[model samples]
Target: MIGRFKAELFLILATVVWGGTFPVISELLSFVDAAYIVGFRFLISAVILFPFLFKGGLFLRIRQGLVDGFILGSLTFSGFYLQTVGLNYTTPARSAFITQLLLIYVLIFQVFAKRKRPTIWNVISTVILFIGAVILVDPFALEGKLNKGDIITGLSAAAFAAYIIRIDHVKSEGRMVSILFSQFVLCSVLGFTLSFVQDAPVPIFNFTSVGFILYLAIPATLFATYTMLKYQPKTTPMRASILYSLEPIFATLITILFLGIWPLKHEVIGGSIVFFAVILSEVSPLLRHTTKPEPKN
Candidate 1:
């Protein structure tokens, strides 16, 4: 139990680091092209992780390590690229609501992939979690046709969901380290190659852009990726996704810190609901364990 919760804690921290990206990237896009930003961030991450390629030679042991990493990497890059571009087309609330759909996707996959129905509480928690995300983002307040950004962000959610499931399916335990390294390598290639192909403007070197990229490369990219590879499998993919659903709440808090924007009433209420949903999920498992009959002497 202790070990599981520790893994959960690490993932929570990873989510927090990920949450910081919204504000950081929003600021970065103004000064640097999004493609350039992606290119540089993942390039640095891949270089740092290059040493791991030789560690234990796990890549060789896990025959599919590079393949799995490529799949995960494509999903990762797609999620990021779509979300970044989607925001330009959609409101933040819409993007939040859509991205949080990733949890549902995982649940859906569990049903089909495992052929196992969710427990009652799992369903309950999922419902509550979804409601909380909806309330927090409050897409209903926006008056317009469903735009490209909303659709694009929803696609990003699917990509992210696929990424999470792939992590669970990785063949070798801790072999995901190799897979993650490969993912970074692929994203780095895609980032730079795409930037050039798309004719993105050459990014101006500045303290702001450099600082943001460095922050992203290490803590957000490397640490966060490592945590996901190492810790996410400790819990069910759905539970991990539930915890990840907190991304918006963390993003809201980040806005308060960096943009000085206090959350509106709806955001406060929604954040509370989402938090309660997470608590319910954590407690449900414990309650089940405690309720089991005692073993015979």
Candidate 2:
């Protein structure tokens, strides 16, 4: 029980770190191109984790990690690149809501891959979560027209969903550290290459932006990736998706704190609904079993 709780806590912390990145990255985009930001941030993360790639007697594991990590890293890169580019064409709120369609993609993929349909509770929770997301983002204001950026962000969500499923599939492979290190390195290389190809202007170094970049690289990229790779397999992919849906909520709070943006009434209501839906999903199974009558011996 304690172990599961700890694992869930770690997942939550990872999501929180991810959520915190929104404001920082949004700010950084003003001074740096999206590709360069991705490049330097991931390069820093690779540097932080580089030493672990050389641990003794892990050559076989490293080989496997290289292949698996490259596959995973490619998917990750696609998601981030599309989403960041999409951000240029859409509002952050719209981008966030669309990006989170990852949950729906994961659920659909799980149904097909596992050859099992979701439980009633799972389906209900998903619906409720979707409703909350709609409320949070208020897409109705968009008048049913999705721009190019919205479509790209939606595709990014699909890539992210595939990435999540891939992580779950590869959990049996050991050497998580090596795998994640490889992923960071690959993403860094891709980011830098794309930045150069696009001729994105180089980011001018300043204290504030540099600090934000380091924060993103260390806590958001390095620590968050480590915890996610280490602990996410402990939970069902659906549950993990639900947990991650909390990112928007966290992002809202962080935005309020850093930018003095107040949460609107709908955001508060939507965030609460999503939060409780997640809690119910986590606890319902336990409650069901506990309430069952004992069988006569």
Candidate 3:
């Protein structure tokens, strides 16, 4: 029980670290292109985690790690690629919300895996939260304007949602460091490869950009990936996901405090709705399973 709680706490801390990264990366974009950001972030992360990769025997689980790494890294790298490109068109806050649509995706995957339909409340919660996101994003504003950034961010959201599902498969097969280190290395290579198509600029070794890369690679990629790979498997996907959904709440606060970006009232309202809905889904299951009636006379 204590172990489970510790795992959950680790997951929560990971989410907090990730949520806090938005403003930093958003600021770094002034000095760095998105592809360069992705590549360099993973490069730093790979550097940090590479030494730990061999703590367990290199080939003791080489075949499994490689297989898992390729598949997970491919999906993860694709999500980052789309997201970085998408950010070229969107607001950081909107991008954060969109990426978190993975919560819904995770729940849906669990439903199918269980071979049972989600409860009516579950469906209702999903719809309510999704609708809340629409309001939060507020697409109809701008006085006869459709934002390309928002659309691109939306697409990235879907891509990331799918990637979260793919990650679950890889989490089960190998050591976390080995798998995550391989993932960072592969993703760095993959991002570099894709950057060519975009005519990515040569990296400039600026202090601010380098610092951002280090933060992203270490806390966001390395630590967060390790926690997700290690902990998500120990809990139900829905539970893991709901805890993860806390990212948006944290992001909003960080953005407001550190980035000087104030959320619209509607965004706060919508995010609250989503937060409550997630609580309902995750807590209800645990309550039902754990609560017992008093003994009959």
Residue 229, candidate 3: alpha-carbon lDDT: 72
Report the lDDT of model 1 for residue 199: 95
Inter-residue clash pairs, candidate 3: 89-149
- lDDT tens digits, residue span 176-285, model 1: 56776778778878888888899988888799889989999999988887788779988887688678868777876786688676766876787677677766765677
lDDT of each: 0.76, 0.76, 0.73
Clashes of each: 0, 0, 1
Clash-forming residue pairs, model 1: none
Which ranges of candidate 1 are over 4 A from the true structure? 1-15, 55-64, 87-98, 144-151, 227-247, 287-297
Q: Which candidate comes out best when scored by TM-score?
A: 3
lDDT of 2 by residue, 1-297 (tens): 677789899999988888877667777787778887778888898787777767665576567588888999899888888887887775454566557667667778889987767766667767886786667556665785547676888789999989988887786455777787778778889999998998888787899889988987899887887787779888776677667878877877777788676666875786676666666565656666787899999
Question: Least lDDT summed over 10 consecutive residues: which range in candidate 3?
Answer: 167-176
TM-score of 1: 0.78
lDDT of 2: 0.76
Residues 89-130 of candidate 3 have per-residue lDDT tens digits of: 665666677665555776676777645577666676778768
